[model samples]
Target: MQGYSAASLKPIFDTHIKNDAQVLADGWCGYNPLKEECPNLKQTLSNKGKNFKMLHIQIRDFKNWLRGVHSYCNKEYLQKYIDEYFFRFNRRNHRKINFR
Candidate 1:
């Protein structure tokens, strides 16, 4: 695993997010490379009101959803479970498009 190394973040920065987008992250050595990669990168210390608030909220919700709905997941199939959740989460606004 790359585990927060500069090498690990290169491709994600290169491919996933656009250069114009702002990259907000907590102060971690792993994210240090982002400064060089992104023009709008903002790395803040892990203090109150400094962290990415909504991102942290979403992460908390995901963990709660996993613990509450799945109870316990096997390591072998955890990726599948997370994928399923994202599938539902991504299309959550289209409840009555065709039906209505």
Candidate 2:
């Protein structure tokens, strides 16, 4: 986002996250406003990423994939690249299943 402010995050949360979905985030002030919009929002200290080990790993892997595979990305298409990566990542275990 342009900045980690509530205004910057609101649109993303509204577009991508369901209101009823449980959301976990670091105890950042930017996420405070989101609690009103998302009833299930939870905030806690990150403990230097230890509290979110798997999430950190996934982020690291995505960065590595971006650097290794694309080398560079256009700012305009960065979101599309992230979406594609997570689409595959989310379905990695279900590859044997047919979509149709």
TM-score of each: 0.81, 0.73
The parts of candidate 2 lying over 4 Å away from their true place are 72-77, 98-100
TM-score of 1: 0.81
Candidate 1 stretches with Cα past 4 Å from truth are 48-50, 98-100
Across 1-100, the per-residue lDDT of candidate 2 in tens digits comes to: 6877999999999999999999999999989888998989999899999999999999999999999989999999999999989988889888779464
Cα error, candidate 2, residue 13 (Å): 2.6
lDDT (tens digit, per residue) of candidate 1 on 1-100: 4576878887888889898888877777877767775878887886874366777787788899999999999999999988988887887898687347
Error of 2 at 70 (Å): 2.8
Residue 31, candidate 1: Cα error in Å is 2.4
Cα deviation at 1, candidate 2, in Å, is 6.2
Which residue pairs in candidate 1 have backbone atoms (N, alpha carbon, C) closer than 3 angstroms, thus clashing? none
How many angstroms is residue 5 displaced in model 2 relative to the true structure, after the best TM-score fit?
Answer: 1.6
